[model samples]
Target: MKAIVKGALAAGVLLIVGAGIVAGLRGSEPSAGPGGAPSSGPPRQRTLTIAAASDLKFALDELLKEFRAKHPGAQVQVTYGSSGNFLAQISNGAPFDLFLSADAAYPRKLAEQGLLSDDVFSYAVGRLVVWVPKGSPLPVEQRGMDALREPAAKRIAIANPQHAPYGRAAEAAMKSKGVYDAVKDKLVLGENIAQTAQFVQSGSADVGIIALSLALAPAMKDQGRYWEVPLDAYPRMEQGGAILKRAEDPELARQFRDFLLGAEGKALLERHGFFLPGE
Candidate 1:
């Protein structure tokens, strides 16, 4: 009985020591947050992939610089190409979070597929121009698409109408100006507005039907001049932007979309030759 009592006393002491040790460890454990937030893990971050039209290269390059400055840790990747080309890729299941088209047609088509909401938003109205390199034989002061009908214009540059919204706009403007039939054979199609501008800038083609924003860029402004196509001549180039339904970061994509529609964004777009919607 004496041995059993001593054994019980020893066990009781061991239990007390173990309990104290557990209490000490518990005291050392980090306190719970008021709402159970992690106290030590790194902050969560998100990345967004945006596909924009090539004409937005200059403007978006500048704007994105500001966007990152505003969002220090947000990851944003932009892919630029013809709006139509971007649509084709998106239709093929490209993993894009957002798309800012150079025209509204593509976004409307996407919305029809239920890949986007029916509520499409117009962001900008692109201007079209006839641009020639620094010293091409083309008269810098010539007005209208009629310039393309000039006998000296043996080879005129244009983007592929079937794939570029701006190209389609250019074609429509040319038809409205009654110059398409005469200048059709002389057409040298480019892949996009940038490429069309390149055809003229490189002396490969006499003049290019290009986005006015591209023509007004620093280099082009210094080397070339353009006459705006009368808005009445062609359908408005109502550009639209929307977030994809399957975006990895739909919320972030929407944030960027709102940013693009904000007043500051409109000012930037105007500075780049994009007119306000309905202007």
Candidate 2:
């Protein structure tokens, strides 16, 4: 009886050891990742790069925060500049997953050139404003574009019309108000709408015709005041974007595009002073 009990105990110990050995072997093997590839550790994160208009600076920043929260494994990067300059870069084969232009025209041009992976979709309508720093004698809020004619408004700033849509819009607004000829000599050109705001903020220019979005941003909101330019003063600034044909991650880009055109995005844009597509 003693020998039988000893034999049973030995067998049980060997079985337990064998099971641990089997488990160890299985653990040592690499796991499969997305497409049945041997994964070393976690899944590789996806990257989405966007070329955006400078007018979207404040608004897009907020949108990206929400995007990252929802897609923990996705990484997003953005470059802001004149939409036309981005168009030129994209035409020349710049690597961007998406292009968010200040107007639909630039992206449509890309689509025409067969540079886009998808159709251009409008996201928002941009508004322009005549802005002046705090404590300025010019009553921009009272006189609107007429304030630019004041002798104290010697150095007026605007985005460069040659490449920036907002700049062209600013020029059009001034022209519509019959102030273009009076202030053309005093007009200082910024490379983009954001820089145009910066010019006035930094005292580089006395006043600026800049995006309403910037004027409402925390950075500039308290530093200055603005009077909205009438919608009829210039051509409509319908902002839009498209996925690039050379996008490394087209699916991810599409997801982001949907989000931008979604409810949350529209709310944030509206808060930042951008008008919605239908309104």
Candidate 3:
């Protein structure tokens, strides 16, 4: 009986030792990670991450959704901000796979700095508008810079020119109209086009100059009306896009870039009041 008990204990110890050896071999063989679990499969095919200017917020998203429908495996995530800021991020290694600027100049600068793919493209032309909220005494089209000049227009809103093309365009228009000097003191700046629209609609500012896309948004429809700023008043808002040179998934970036310039994408941009260069 004592020998039988000793034999059983020996068998149990051997079984435990064999299991440890099996586990160590499996771990050393790369079949398992250091955590002693099965190794993860191949790395995921990364999605394209685009950092676009704020004005392209909605239009770009609508196009992205369309692209995703056609290519279920590929994904696109958009981060929208000022063109200038987005440009800086590209320079500082922001991990943005692509950039779509509110103006072409930034993309051009990126290309000149060798931060962009060889094939940068002009995707769309952005338009600026002078907008006045509905039910307000101010008339948008009839008033123009004159409304901004009115004492009633004490709080006129425009985007910060340092950041937004629409703001620069509005500033140029103000200068062209010879109202910048008079209204500059009254100008309240928004960080971006979307916020500029909000300043007027919410009555935080008496009036605003914002992107046509925002003015055309359903929420803004009842809230405001806008007149397209004359193109000559400012340099063309030539929006451009490119895949970043440092992108880990450059082909995915290229696919998104092509998709944005394609027929469906162009139509989406047009539907939202963005004009093409050829248009």
Estimate, for each residue in 246-279, the C-alpha lDDT of model 1 and write its tens digit: 8887876777777777887888989998998877
Clashes of each: 0, 0, 0
Backbone clash total for model 3 is 0
Clashing pairs in 1: none
Tens digit of lDDT per residue, candidate 2, span 63-90?
9888877776677778888888899999
lDDT of each: 0.74, 0.83, 0.72
What is the Cα-based lDDT of residue 277 in candidate 3?
A: 75
TM-score of 3: 0.82
lDDT of 3 at 140: 65
Winning model by lDDT: 2
The reply for model 1, stretches above 4 Å from the true place, is: 1-43
Better of 1 and 2 by lDDT: 2
| Ten contiguous residues with the weakest lDDT in model 1 | 14-23
User: How do these models rank on lDDT, best leading?
Assistant: 2, 1, 3
Pick by lDDT: 2 or 3, better one = 2
